[model samples]
Target: MTQNPPIRRALLPATALLAALALAGCSGGGSVRVAAPVTTGSTAEQCAALKAALPATLQGRKLRDTTPESANTAAWGNPAITLRCGVGTAAVLDPHSPAYDLNADIEESGGVCWVSEQTAGGGFRFTTVRQQATVELTLPAAYAGGQSPVGLLAGAVLKADPVVRDRPFACV
Candidate 1:
């Protein structure tokens, strides 16, 4: 029986491959980074909750009075507070239309509409109306008073209403 020469593998190529893998491990792998959980619930409840949960800094802060007058189209958050929703702007379904008129006084809009609330901090936030079954909610880290706004909002909503539904709201 003839014994074949012991197969010898190249060490340089193997070492290079190992080094590459180690470098990749040191860097970021193909792993996905999971963000904080987004809570979803009734649009109105959530809105009211967030509004009531606003920190002291934002509670009395007067935002630009740009809320719409239409009951259906208007925002439903704290009457005194305002967020930068950029309302009163005309909608543009087609920007390249031959009749495209930027000077039109008509008020048109798009996207999920809803009332906005001020964060515990100075930032203003709002919840998007759900065209479907669920609405996503991102809680701020702290209010202007350095407190979690989500918990406060949730508590307020719960206290105000005995039974709060996690369903979409007709506000939008």
Candidate 2:
């Protein structure tokens, strides 16, 4: 009677185990969904024009330039207390950017500030680039002043509108 070789049997199981380990290691970890900044126009004047066109709820907000991490953590339509909670959860999802300043400034006044992305340095290394945008929001009004403006804006923006646009980028 013919019998299988021990070395061949060992190799098969070892190969399978190695393959499984490789697959597990390849999977990315701590992936969070983040919104990308947008460019509506050029120059501060154009910025003002763009701001004017945003939904009325966002009109009163300020304008500032900051990082992508800062972009997704602002308050959109409510007070600081609620905004703080939203920011905490939102930051976990958005990606961080070092190029732009992620700006937000009061356009008209009344506890409001418009936050978005501004064009800055370009070209970098990344496995893939993702495109995301801030959209409509519903905030709680009032925020603790100690927080950075960027964080405030991103969280506020998300709270203002939970829904937004998303895209992907592959840096070559």
Candidate 3:
């Protein structure tokens, strides 16, 4: 039996570890799956503008590619802080809609207002309030105790989607 060199012995473990990590990453973890919203005409144009203005990173997470590859959707991080532009107005924001909530906590950060609702998964989904083209963000439960991620995208959203003056909802 021949003994392997010290460097070769060390390289064997490292190489094996690398291969294992690569396989783990290939098992449906590389890209996030997000439902893309349908938009047309001016809304589609606004979504495109918002996409262009999005930051390359959010919080400390580098932006990752989303599945289905839509210009209307973006994501960041493993748990994924996802954004879908040109979404339909949520019922909570519609005064005439039965789902409207008079006591909704409309939060304002970085000059944009949002209506947040908790999801069944313990995460939170926030939608832009009173914007021409609604933008929705889904924050994973892992981010619950952290600082608000909304401020990071505020500038982009503010520039891309003008406020709908006719809408009754507004951040107090």
Measured by lDDT, the strongest candidate is: 3
Each candidate's TM vs. the true structure?
Answer: 0.22, 0.20, 0.82
Report lDDT (CA) for all predictions: 0.33, 0.30, 0.87
Q: Using TM-score, give the best candidate's number.
A: 3
CA-only RMSD, every prediction? 19.9, 19.0, 4.6
Model 1, 1-172: lDDT tens digits are: 7544442345667788899999866653322222222233543444344344434433333222222321111111233222211122212212565533444322111323333444466554444332221122222333334432333233333343333234323332
Query: After TM-score superposition, what is the CA distance of residue 171 in candidate 1 from its true location, in Å?
Result: 7.6
Model 2: per-residue Cα lDDT over 87-159, one tens digit each: 2112212456333222322121122223322213321111111212323222222332232333333433333
User: Candidate 3, residue 96: CA error in Å?
Assistant: 7.1
Better of 2 and 3 by TM-score: 3
lDDT (Cα, 0-100) at 105 in candidate 2: 21
Alpha carbon lDDT at 90, candidate 1: 19
Displacement of residue 7 (Cα, Å) in model 2 is 2.2
Model 3 scores worst on lDDT over the 10 consecutive residues at 24-33
TM-score ranking from best to worst?
3, 1, 2
